[model samples]
Target chain A: MDCSFENEIHLEQLMPLIEEYLAQGKPVKFSPRGISMLPMLRQGVDSVILESYKGVPRKYDIPLYRRDDGCFVLHRVVKVGKTYTCIGDNQFNLEHGIRHDQIIAIVTGFYRGTKYYSVNNMGYLLYSRIWHCSRGIRHFCGRCLAGIRRRLR
Target chain B: MKIKDGYIVREVAGTTVVLPTGDDLDLTKMIKLNDTGKFLWQELQQDTDEDRLVAALLREYSVDEATARAGVQRFVNKLKDNGLLI
Candidate 1:
């Protein structure tokens, strides 16, 4: 007989704190959305635990958003400025600039598929790089697909 | 917005982008876009109507009046046909 250990993170277990950091800019949860965080996080599936992002976030780092519509958006931080600017990795340009105080957390980890990984560690930067460098082209393709998706139905 | 010159567009991370061509979307089977197609997509996001969109494309891409008008019409028709337009 053998015994093994594995770590599991659950969404119900994660939501309260995520709500906290996110709304108050205190302890936050940076849930994954869309394909921008791809190769790192999955769309509509992956999620992360975030703390109050205190320092400046670097280019290619993912940031949690409280959008103008009061909806939260999670996208990549593409430029470091007095007001941080983020865009989806496959986007044409930075969608909006947020005050530093508005950011909930810089994504420190990712959950791809069923496995959990640390963005602070190795093997993750490569994924981030591909998303950043290829953003423009990726957005182009995605927009094309959006058109196609509409047509197919 | 029209795509900048010398680069094609692609989608990554759910956002439309303009990069070198040839990168195919490999994640989901749906929601993919090419460069010129992305330029058209951006225009839809803006407040401009179809005629303004055609004019803008002509200025940016520097195509002849007929070509730009035709491209914009095709893209807008596709958008309407697909129910993306109101």
Candidate 2:
């Protein structure tokens, strides 16, 4: 496998240090490296401040969790209880039964350019609720866009 | 100039970064360190000047004096801009 990717570390390798900040009750900020949290978060361009997850995650909270296969995911919570159900905004499927232990952090704020927007920010709250509610329309629009691109090719 | 306290060089899965802890985390950008940047960050942890950093780079890597100086200058300027220097 090609390993030319530089300046990027696996989430597992970085978690201990992040946990130290969390344990101190300090928020940790880092750039997420994927498109799974697009629109609100842009890979490399946007960074997020993650707080340590306490108790069960509430609906619409974005969480950073690690899977059994050691892959790390930052997705939005859509359900709660014995286990959580999460789905990325760009994704249509729901990931169910994600235990509390799997969740390491919860995103409280995000930085777009130099500006920081807290989850409690009115715009952010409205965006999350509206986005979650409009998944069907967004998904359909995405399919239409893909089909257009295919036809263009 | 000296590196500020609460800012540390951390390596994870081969990625090196200058991370700020405690009240030092006012910055919005995450600073990723390359190999040379990592070396300089470790050196700057103790108070040192630009020339000393260049000399250290010359000793550590096979780079020549001018290149080392430029590298040191670039790294120091970046830290300075980020308000990471004390």
Candidate 3:
């Protein structure tokens, strides 16, 4: 997903509405939670923009899943197979495969503050490749940032 | 709580199912289950206690105690591995 649809929100304010949107079939939203999609999504800053699933996702499309435990995540599909295999752009390890039925939304666009971008466009291609190449370093940085967030929280 | 509580689980056509109620879930993290797993899931909703659940499945499926216990244990292990249970 590219950064395009930005909705300003405080963490406290965003949470309730995100919850409500999920329950109401309203436009889905959430603050990016990790650097998994780093350089594309920023933790605690970039806001996610989701379109309800309209069909099976194609390669490179970002999709969201509602895990049995109820946490939601956004990741890009690396492979479309008997099960969809998704991976974070800036991270190692493929996430567990999810059936097409498990997908809740397709990330049609993204917003980093006020800037918007499209996933299908060239601007996103450059960013995604950079993210893929620097994944090792970015993942290390991401883990450190995660630890800091945990302690601060 | 109601069986579904604040959430709704409804099957939609073409694998693009919907979970229209509750929190915005990160669907990417879910561990996809096969038919056996789905059957075991419904059974969990009916009863989660380990022993009682095993007993019920034993009766319902007309399986021997050993076979039922093994099946229950394997399924429960998978659930735990996926972080679906405490």
Among these predictions, the greatest TM-score belongs to: 2
TM-score of the second chain for every model = 0.61, 0.86, 0.59
Task: Return the TM-score for each candidate structure.
Answer: 0.45, 0.76, 0.46
Q: Give the top-scoring candidate (lDDT).
A: 2
Is 2 or 3 the stronger prediction by DockQ? 2
**Candidate numbers, best lDDT first, in rank order:** 2, 3, 1
lDDT of 3 by residue, B7-85 (tens): 2333322121223253554332323334444455566655367687667676666677777777777777655664555
Better of 1 and 3 by lDDT: 3
User: Looking at candidate 2, what is the lDDT of residue A146?
Assistant: 100
Worst-scoring 10-residue span by lDDT in model 3 chain A: A1-10
Per-residue lDDT tens digits for candidate 3, residues A1-153, read 010111232333333434445556655555667687876788766766676677688877888776666666678887788888788876688876678777876787777876777676788877766665676886798799999999999
Estimate, for each residue in B1-86, the C-alpha lDDT of model 1 and write its tens digit.
33323343343344443322223211211223445566666765656676887776776675777777777777766555544455
- In candidate 2, what are the lDDT values of residues A1-153, reduced to their tens digit? 010113455567677667777887877787888788778889878988888888778999999999888888999998888999998887888899899899888998999877989999999999998998999898899899999999999
- Top-down TM-score ranking: 2, 3, 1
Please identify model 3 stretches exceeding 4 Å from their true place.
A1-26, A129-153, B1-86
Tens digits of lDDT, candidate 1, A34-55: 6754555665566665555766
TM-score of chain A of each: 0.65, 0.87, 0.66
